[model samples]
Target: DGVGLMTAADVSAYAHADDGGVEAFVTAGVDVRGWAARPGEGAAGVQDPGTINVVVAVPAALTDAALVNAVATATEAKVQALVEGGYDCSGTPTDAVCVVADAPGPHREAHAFAGPRSLWGARLARAVHRAVLQAVVIADRDGPAVRGQA
Candidate 1:
C-alpha cells in the first residue's frame, strides 16, 4: 500500500567493528518504507511483519545483564542509522534483533555492562550502525519498487 524500497530478495549488509580486544559482527536486512514508523508516531498497538532484521555477534563473553543491554544498544544504533539515512521513522513495527556473545569460559571474564559507553557495547553499536546504514543505503539506491521478500 506504500512505496517499496530495495528488492524483496537478498537485500542485506554486513559490518564488523573492533575496539581493544572486543570484536563485533553485524548483519542487517532492511526493507522498510511501507511499514516504517516511529515508536509513538504509529498506531498504538499494531504488530506488523518484521521488515528490518539484525543479528549481532560479539567475541567476548557477556553477563546476562550485558546481553540485555547489548540489545538496547543495537536497537538504538539501528534507529540512528535509519534517521541518518533520511528515514522519517525509527523503524518498522516488527523489527527484529538477535544478539549473540561468546559463552563464558573458565579463564574468561564476563562483561557486566554493554551500554553505548562500554567498550564491547561501543563496538557492537558501531558494527550494527554500519550494517544498518549500508542496508538503508542499498534500499534507497534501489528505489521504491521492491520490498524485501526473498
Candidate 2:
C-alpha cells in the first residue's frame, strides 16, 4: 500500500501547480516531508496490489460529510498521481481509491482523518482493522495457504 497527501512535494512538482519549476517551488516553499505514495513494508495501510496512504489539510468543522468529502478529494488526487506515475486504472480514477469498508471485492485498507486527528491513530486503526479482517478471511479461506506479507 501507499501514503497519500494533498500537498505532496513530488506530486506538486509533477503537477507543476506552481508558477516556477518543480525544484524551485519545492525548495523554496514546499514541506520537505510532504509526500504521497503507497505504503512500504513497515508502514500502515491497506494491504493490496497497490494501495496508497495519504493526508489532506481539512477544515476544523469535522463533519461526517466533510470527512467523507475530504476522503473523496484525497482519493482522487492520489489516484491521479498514481496514473501520472503510470498506474493503469483504466479511465475510472475512483477505482484506485475507495472507502475501506467497500473494498470493491479487492483486499484493501485505509485510514480516515478529521482535520486534527493524529496520523498515528488513523494509521493504527487502518492497520489493525484491515489486518485482522484479512487474517480472519485467510483463516477461513479454503484450498489456499494463508500467509502474511509485510
Candidate 3:
C-alpha cells in the first residue's frame, strides 16, 4: 500500500450569509489523505498531514468572549458539514480555523454573544456550513483518490 499526497489544495469553497445587519463570509479548503476517521477511532501512529482550513470574516465588532464563541460556532458548523457529507470523521487532525471581525470602537458596544442560536452566530454558522459543504462536493467530484484517499 502507498500513501498519496497532493501538493495543492484538493478542494475549496466559499459562502456568505447575513442576518439583520450582521454578515459573515466564509472560505474553506479540504484535503483528506485517506486518514479521515472519527476522533479516537483511527490508528494511533502519526501520518502525513492532510488539512481542512476555514476562515470566517465578519463586519461587526464583537467582545472577546463573542470572538471565542465565534470560533467554536464555526468549528461546530464544520463538523456538521462533514457529517452531512457522509464523512466518518469530524475533520482531519491538522484541520485549522480562523475567525475575523471588526474591532469595537471606544464608544461602541461589541456583540456580547456569538452562539449558534444568536443572530450573528446563526449567520456565521450558515455561511461556514455552506462553504464546507461546497468543498466536500468539490472533493467528491474530484474523486477521493485525488484527495489522497481511496
Runs in model 1 lying further than 4 Å from the true structure: 1-50, 142-150
**Taking the tens digit of each residue's C-alpha lDDT, what string does model 2 give over 42-137?**
345542322232332221323454457545544444434323433333112112222222222233333344221344224322332233223222
Off by over 4 Å in 3: 1-46, 142-150
Candidate 1 per-residue lDDT over residues 51-114, each given as its tens digit: 6666677788999999999999988988887767666556765566777888889999999999
Score each candidate by Cα lDDT: 0.67, 0.29, 0.67
What's the count of clashing pairs in each model shown?
A: 5, 13, 0
Please report, as a residue range, the 10-residue window in candidate 2 with the lowest summed lDDT.
22-31
| Deviation from native of the Cα of residue 100 in model 3, angstroms | 0.4
Q: What is the Cα-based TM-score of model 3? A: 0.70
Evaluated at residue 99, the lDDT of candidate 2 is 25
Cα-based TM-score, every candidate: 0.69, 0.28, 0.70
